[model samples]
Target: MGKILITPRGYAKYGDEAGKRLEELGYELNVNRSGLPLSREQFVESAKEATGIIVGVDECDEALLKQCKDLKAIVKFGVGVDNIDLDAAKALDISVGRCVGTNSNAVAEYTIGLMFAASRHIVAAGCDVRSGGWKKPTGVELYGKTVGIIGFGNIGKHVARIANGIGMKVLVYDVFDIKQEDLDTYNAKSTNVEDIIVNSDFITLHVPLNDETKNMISTKEFRQMKKSACVINAARGGVVDEKALYEALKNGDIFASASDVFTSEPPERTDWVNELIAMDNFILTPHIGSRSEESEINTVNKATDIMIELLENHD
Candidate 1:
């Protein structure tokens, strides 16, 4: 009944429409003064007075939740809730929400686009044309290539379908097996992670960020990949060790990489990471996996609409 706290810099993009509706419910909005992710103490102090919060990648651990006594709900800006401590929120009687399957297709499309962009060095070609150079960049072909899709959920499955349509053979590596129906429909093959990594011409990740996955693709895994294989990560950061990835790229162990997320949200241009960028082998995007205008509006609408339903109908 008091107010809602919005964190980081993207409220208007994701929540402004829903905010208009919430205004009719008499909610004031407070934004984090910090321009980036909030530390636990900082998040708690700023959000303690609010009944609800719209968050983006800020730390919402048990300590922060404990301080926010009046908190009623949390609306994560995107699909991944790795930043929020759900157990504590539940114990504290706060309802937690996220936009699931909202941007799967958009992200899947971006993944394939990145693969093409990397194999063809599209970014470098644009720069070459801009610089008045006529040198045609040699780019690899995706057709007939074996694409290893790690974590075949909605996004990964969609990626496989598109890749198959483009004449690429899809090999999926999921903890769970790919269903026979799905494998047949998309003409994808299910295999173990080791085989997929060793065999894939291009590898893209689609999974959550958590214990079993943090630094999941590191030095050992890099060693398993073909020297000519490339990597794509539009999923959460830290899945591939950026440092190791840089080393691999620098040493020509892997052919190229395209990453949409980073270990750091506003990921800095570290010297090693920049080295990869300087070479044509690496492509970096600022976590805009779900930034489609339609996706943004739908994410906000879905989150706020659910809260509105819960708030107005206690019966």
Candidate 2:
């Protein structure tokens, strides 16, 4: 049996590369081809005998973590470690690590694209024009506007560079450290959340979704934004309250919004999902910001590296 039973769809977009990496590691690796995420029972059964797992940002919750007696380490594919039950991992001595800088540029680029798609009504306009509606929409421009970034990490910095390239001023606010040199290099301004909310023409969230950031942008924050301002969330879900965002856009408090992540995965007939789909001002992607070819390779390498490090030395 393979010492590692990688959860299915570990690299849904690039399976061949993942296979090669595991082959080179000289350890048994199983490919997950279930066409869906492993069911919890399936997860428990499959991983019960494994020494390590390379996981995505799916749920690695308490009940799921408890079944893995042989699990020595978990290597996350991307930056967000929220899926893993960290407290449980710590208690079980399961070392966890993620790919940090690997996919930042990809996500940054996607966020900017989402901004254009939303501002210009790209999707809506294309469909309209194809259907014989000659409404050449007047879209907002990025030049001479402020772009607010919630987090000042790798992804946030890259977003600053891209947004600045389009002549957009960058403003950042983080509870964590924001270096002055980085601010100077990017010609970005660093301040509190209020300044970002009030001044930004476009607000793009790059922060992790944790206790402090959960629902950080809500009705009150939305009310603070300019009537013409909009928001983009390419980071983790739950960083902004979906209900509040819906209300903000629905009530015309803000111009528009877009998000790659949602509070629920495969959302089942929720009010928020319904509202967003109904609104032409909203753009939603099924969490594909970091699944580019290069990023997938980077994430797989990071996950495999973690597994190799633990399996050969620690275990």
Candidate 3:
């Protein structure tokens, strides 16, 4: 029987049935007990004897992959695999799988929520009411606004759908070309990133974190946006430079901004992050883009299936 290590904090709770299935298939399940993402040392220690792993955000670099000689398969519970070292995994002959599209709807909905929260000052307004203040801040409407969607992948497509339903014009910027029929379906137009950055009323990022995409939106991009525009990043962190974002927000280069992911998880209370958090127009969420109950179940099942197949079929 092969041993499978599961390192995602939510897997044990949301993946109990999947765990049972793996056990029934004769695999020993070693789940992470930390209730948080495993550090590099913890991950290496936990994964040493396992033939497979269901990972989340934990760094699986070349050094760690080489150390875990028994590790044959890695199943990513979420879409982004930036934390996993793919080149190293391939070199080490370990199979890597990701549960793509499993959390699309969940993340897409959250992106819309962030947009509304920023545009309407929803968080600030709620705080005011709770604090015995009665200030009704003027806010912008989504209807008829131009929404720029960066990277029209699974999550981006769903975001476009919701934006269209809200009567917003959607401009899509992606590296790959989207079909005209598909664009027409959502009443969207294929445009360059520059156009989206300059012309959008609300800009939402959905790109992955990679060398090309890292710091994709910095001071220059922020400068291009209209002063009334609001930016939403429910995608990966590091895509937008936090320091540049701080400067932009502080100077009112853009009206407001919201981010669900950051360059670092449980971001340190650095001066830049603290300053950004202190701004009323800046909204931050602790990377809950795929935290919905439904999304969790779907991702867990998908990840489990992939792990089982890879391990069972390994020669």
Best-fitting candidate, measured by lDDT? 3
Error of 2 at 54 (Å): 0.4
> What global local distance difference test value does model 3 have?
0.91
Per-residue alpha-carbon lDDT of candidate 1 for residues 1-315, written as tens digits (9 for 90 to 100): 678887846556456676878888898877665556676676777788888888877788888889887888887877899989999988888888887777788899999999999999998888888989877879889999999999998889899989988999999988886789999988998898888889999999998999999888988888889988999999999999989998888888889999999998677777876676677778888898777777767666777776676556422
Estimated TM-score for each candidate: 0.89, 0.93, 0.97
Residue 150 displacement (Å), model 2: 0.7
Evaluated at residue 234, the lDDT of candidate 3 is: 92
Off by over 4 Å in 1: 8-11, 14-17, 30-45, 309-315
Per-residue alpha-carbon lDDT of model 2 for 51-106, expressed as tens digits?
78777755787777788887887877788989899999888877777778989989
Sort order, TM-score high to low: 3, 2, 1
Please give the TM-score that candidate 3 achieves against the real structure: 0.97
Judged by lDDT relative to the true structure, which candidate is superior, 1 or 2? 1
Instruction: Give per-model CA RMSD.
Output: 2.8, 2.0, 1.3
TM-score of model 2 (CA atoms): 0.93
- Give one digit per residue, the lDDT tens place, for model 3 in 22-48: 999888999987676667777788888
In model 2, where do residues sit more than 4 Å from their true spots?
8-26, 130-132, 313-315
User: If ranked by lDDT, best first, what sequence of candidates would result?
Assistant: 3, 1, 2
Model 2 residue 207 distance off true place after TM-score fit, in angstroms: 1.0
Candidate 1, residue 307: CA error in Å?
2.5
